[model samples]
Target: MAEALREQQLCLSRFIRDPHSNPAPPGIEARRLAVYRQLFLGNMQSLLAGSFPVLSATLAQTQWQSLTTEFYACHRCKTPLFTEVAGEWVSYLETRSDLPGWVAELAHYEWIETVLLLSDNADPAHDPEGDLLDGVPLLSSLAMPLAYAWPVSHIGPDQLPLEAPVEPTLLLARRGADQKIHFARLAPLAHALLVSLQQQLLTGREHLDALAQRAGVERGALERQGIALLHGLKAQGVVLGTVRG
Candidate 1:
């Protein structure tokens, strides 16, 4: 009896997800089944549209509907929460080769703001006035360094690019103290530094010295410019001063 009930539930769910492919559950009214199918797919589309407005806007209405419908029918979402539905869609897009290659990257770029905003991680204890060079520079928990092949930050309804640029797009996505999410372009050096900071808990000067070595530049020259960059990051709240000793 339990197995039969489970099978019925699966049939109903599958049909609701893709009525065109999956047969309607036995003994259910066609009218009611259509309503259920519409409700489920419509809700998923609406939720994804909110999360990835840029992607939704860039695609034609039919394209967007078809994309969402395919995701609804084919993707297996691990989470039941509406907030996570966008992430699932992004993941699903990554696996799809039929779609444009830049589509997944664009979706990820737009979805980043949602990820940072929903994160419950509190800021780590740090000094707001400590020296960045002398002490360890602490990046805010909300700040994320992202590198993408597609120029996702620039892609929109009217500004889609046919091919990726020679240089990869590097971005810093951070949630500020005021609870606002912001994105900024990062230079190659800055991107590498932030990525290194994540991997190592070294002082700002030490990180710069290592960076200079890697770049085959004079340590003193790089230090001057690197220190200024570090200061600017602190000003933007990306570098939350220094780690509290």
Candidate 2:
């Protein structure tokens, strides 16, 4: 009896996962299987659609449907939570060869906003008014740096690029005190500085010196420019403040 039940479960699982290719278990009504398939796949489609609205908008309806169905059929999601399905979809894209090269990057960019929205990271304790150059700069726990090869930030239904740009896109997504998420395009220098700050090992002055050396500029001039940039980031709530030490 146990072996029979196990076989039945396996057959049902295969049918539900890929109804088009897999036959239903013996004695199961076709209509009943169809209802189950529709319910399960529809829910998955709706969840992914909500999570990746921009990707959905960029693709043709048939393409989107085909992509989602492929994901549903082949991707064994790592998490049972509905909120994480979009993340799973992003991962699934990495294994696919038929889709456009930019699709994965675009889906990941959309997923970052969802991740920031649901992040439980709290504001770090720091002096908001502290000097940015003199002390170590502390990046907000809610902000993240992202880089993409295909200008994922600019891609949409009307703005899809057929070829990758020469320069990669760098962006920062930061959640504000009001709980609103904001995205900012960053110059390569600004993005590198923010990444340095995130490491939490370098003081603001050290970062400036390192950046100056990389750019082969005078440290004093870079320090002046770096301070201005840090101040602007502080105003935008991306850099929380300087550490006491």
RMSD of 2: 1.9
The per-residue C-alpha lDDT of model 2 at residue 113 equals: 87
Cα displacement (angstroms), candidate 2, residue 112, comes to: 1.1
List the global CA lDDT of all models. 0.91, 0.88
Off by over 4 Å in 1: none
Clashes of each: 0, 0
Candidate 1 worst ten-residue window by lDDT: 17-26
Q: What are the RMSD figures for all models against the true structure?
A: 1.7, 1.9
1-245: candidate 2 lDDT, tens digit per residue: 99999999999989998988888899989999899888989998998899899999999999999999988898888898888887899999877887888999999998988898899977667888887887888898899988898988888999989999899999999887788888889998899899889875577899999989998989998888899999999998889888865
